[model samples]
Target: MIIKRTIRPLFSVIFVFAVAAVTLFFRAIVSGAGRDPYPDQNPFIISQTKHIPSLFNATLLKFSDVDLADASLRQNVEQLVDGDFLSFRTNRQRSFLSAGRYRLDIGVRNVRGSAMDLRSPEFHQLRLDFRRVLKDWWRQRRFDSEVLSKSNLVNALKGVKYKSCAVVGNSGILLKSNRGEEIDRHDFVIRLNNARIGGYERFVGSKTSLSFMNSNILHLCSRRGGCFCHPYGEKVPIMMYMSQPIHFLDYAVCNSSYKAPLMVTDPPLDMLCMRIVKYYSVKRFLKETGKELESWSGLHGGTEFHYSSGMQAIMLALGVCDKVSIYGFGKSDTAKHHYHTNQKTELSLHDYQAEYDLYEDLVNNPQAIPFISDKFKFPAVVIHR
Candidate 1:
């Protein structure tokens, strides 16, 4: 009886192993059949020339050589296990690459209006509408003629030429990441509002080239009864964006009280961000997913659409830096909202899912790497070089 029972259990184990082996064998056959024909041609690498150098000048795949958008989406869904989110990533990446190659020339006499410039006259005509938005923002700001003329909006980046940049978000996923050395090695580092590097420098890094914040945050951080009089460290430049008329008051305080250099985002630039959000809503969601975007006010419950400060930092980095690496941008179920604060925040105040989609898109970008992890993984995305 004992021998019979032992043999039965052994048979069960062997049967299970055989089934798994058969399954894997068929899976391998399917994958091999559908694999990319040109393994050496990577669409991720952005080059200016139409002719891609091959050992034999062989006909390699170009961005148009294959339906890359579909291929990337498939891979993202199979590997990341999120279909809709990966769809946004694939779409956004394609949109970015369609406009221009990955380099941003800081010293050029004139920067392109859109990172994705079009040679077609039709596109140029369409961009005039965007120009109107900028015009409206400029007229509304009503800056002192002298101040406006003397000040160069992007003068903070006048002498700066960064090969690499790290845009650090406030997400708690960075708590245990020992990536301080990796972050600091970059030529420039940017942080968002109220980002605390103290005591957590080993995890979040200590360098700050530029810091971005909106008016409401500035008011709270600088006011007499506010939580923090000076949240950011000295010598780090502040880039403040306008949200309300009250922001003007906060801007004044920051300029006067804070010894660090302060630059207000130009009306055109600020308006451009608004337009970008609108563009995403129209193209990314309504058309692709058949889903509509929901608007959320701040924690206080107001009535305007809000963009996360992390995304603002990312857009800014993409405009100036040659390559950008995003850290502490995504949140897992187990992680806290903010790394520095013990108190949890109401995430519903912003469109976090949509923003995460954008970050995922950037992660798949060849020039941009985003760090996302569930566990306390040391490095999130492996740098190929």
Candidate 2:
């Protein structure tokens, strides 16, 4: 009886220790401790989330009954229905605005319109074909004839290199810098997200050669009457990267009305930008925190994290410009988030500090940039305070 009692107590103690060890193991797995998070799939490869739908498939065919009955909404519906003609007229107006400017030899063709009326059978059929082309692009990332006809960005940038380019960001630090003339001196000036330039011309230059934007900006414009999205005048060429698949429909509708070049970033270039930014962000996270890679997504809003528009602009400038100068890409604790707005906090989705680090690397050590192919010859980069 004494031996049995002694053995029972020892067995109970061992069982308690085993339970504690299992609990710790499970906690480690849940917290992504002591493990590589993305072992099965290569983190470098672009992976599509199954939860996010590829297309929104918004209806553009007919107006709702409620819209027709309301006179106030009737005009907007009519604008949607007559988008093609309005777009043609807008294009003509933009052409007029661009008159006598030093136009590029790039083929900026006039959009041809049929004599058939908007409600006519032929016109509707043409619209259907255009919509199909947009859907195909979203699904396959193929540049069809319609896309080529509407956009001259590729042709304008092809084989021609700029001597110097300035990429301007919207950070409020620009208010402190009286570098407008300096910014305008570059051969080409690229601005981001339709930032205001009216009263702030002394800080941000009056000249804009190109406007790079996210698809969200265009989507917002698509909601307005006639899709009036010309904040930097109607003649400046626009290059935008798609942020949402639904914005493809926005492009399809608004692109018809744009006079100057309106183009989406090619899939290859978009993927390259994504990979480079991700690499920098991940590297920063690992170095600064000494944390496992698995914990990064949880802290950074998972798949929602994205590079800022300024980063993409810099990448494009690197490819096409001989020298790139960046301005207004920094943040200060006291400064507002944007010079043109009252917003003070940075967006949670973007890691501005990580992007600044990237800019620093680009300026000081171009060879050290990771994930870019060795074939790419990075141009000289300078960042201005």
Candidate 3:
């Protein structure tokens, strides 16, 4: 045991060296791409129209080398998954329909079954009721009044140069390194269920950007005991979004895009739901006019498969930026025991690892510039050095 213990230090040193080498190599690759000359444009914006966008189709794959200038192709893909973008509902019926499209029913209501044949009539009736509720929502959507304004956000971002932002998950490791400040310093910072940022000023620091947490996280509150991880209750981000003033850009990427079993934000059913993210791509376009686009798949509507948890943030990322660096994303192998944040947004009844692996594969396999924060797991702050 002593021998192993003594050798363990040596092994850890070598491992760290390898990681450092990889980091350097990765940075070189990233910086080289940075220097490759801006492609005379920004991607992620679409041509605005009077009517809603229509869905084209969805593939299991994502494209890193997408050509952004092709508006028609981009628009098709977006229309397909647009249905999953920013749904929130209040009632059980509304929530079920909003979320059900993305959830594949596998068992008879045991786990989500791929086939609903075995579902009880009660379940079938529930599904029907939810479907009706969604249709009503769709009808109400036409009457929705969306308001978007450009503010001084860009100026607020003076001296900030992170073109690619990494949205971190709430794993406990952030507490170790005081990553909150580091995250805030990034050109852009998106935190998922940003629960424990309050009072841990040394750790969380001055977070300027927005968060993407749902009502459940708001209700349950993600602060547990001791480790800044848990199921404690407190005020949440939704209220902030409701009250905060304009920056050129400020938003909370909704993780539950497809599952908007919406509760009325104000009184009156006449008041439609308003989310800034629905127009994220447009904002990207407004920021940079000339960049070519990749796929605009997210602009439309589609079947249930489109809106899974954590998908919204990525989709929002896809709509606005060319190169993306995902942070706080949990690894497929260790999702259940994810050591980052307190609560994980569950996307399915199936094994989380399998689904997460699939999601990660869809991103990395496409050769996108993935600054995956999930790969390195350790104590406290891992300063970029």
Q: Give Cα-based local distance difference scores for all models.
A: 0.52, 0.66, 0.33
Summarize candidate 1's per-residue lDDT along 107-183 as a digit string, tens digits: 11101222223445533443343334334444654322122122243355664445788888888888857888888
Query: Which has the higher TM-score value, candidate number 1 or candidate number 3?
Result: 1
Indicate the residue-level lDDT of 321 in model 3: 34
RMSD of 1: 20.1
Model 2, residue 325: what's the lDDT? 95
Off by over 4 Å in 2: 1-159
Model 3, range 1-385, lDDT digits (tens) per residue? 9999999999999999999999999999988755524344232222122331211001111232122223542332233223321222221211212334243223222122122342467445544443453344334432212110111222223323345555555444445555555556565555555445556556545453445544344322211111111222212222111110100001111212213221212211111111112122223333444433332333222111122223344433332333345544444433432343455555332233333433454454422112222232211112121
Better of 2 and 3 by TM-score: 2
Candidate with the greatest TM-score versus the true structure: 2
Candidate number achieving the greatest lDDT relative to the actual structure: 2
Count: clashes, candidate 1: 1
How many residue pairs collide in each prediction?
1, 0, 56
Which of 1 and 2 is ahead in TM-score?
Answer: 2
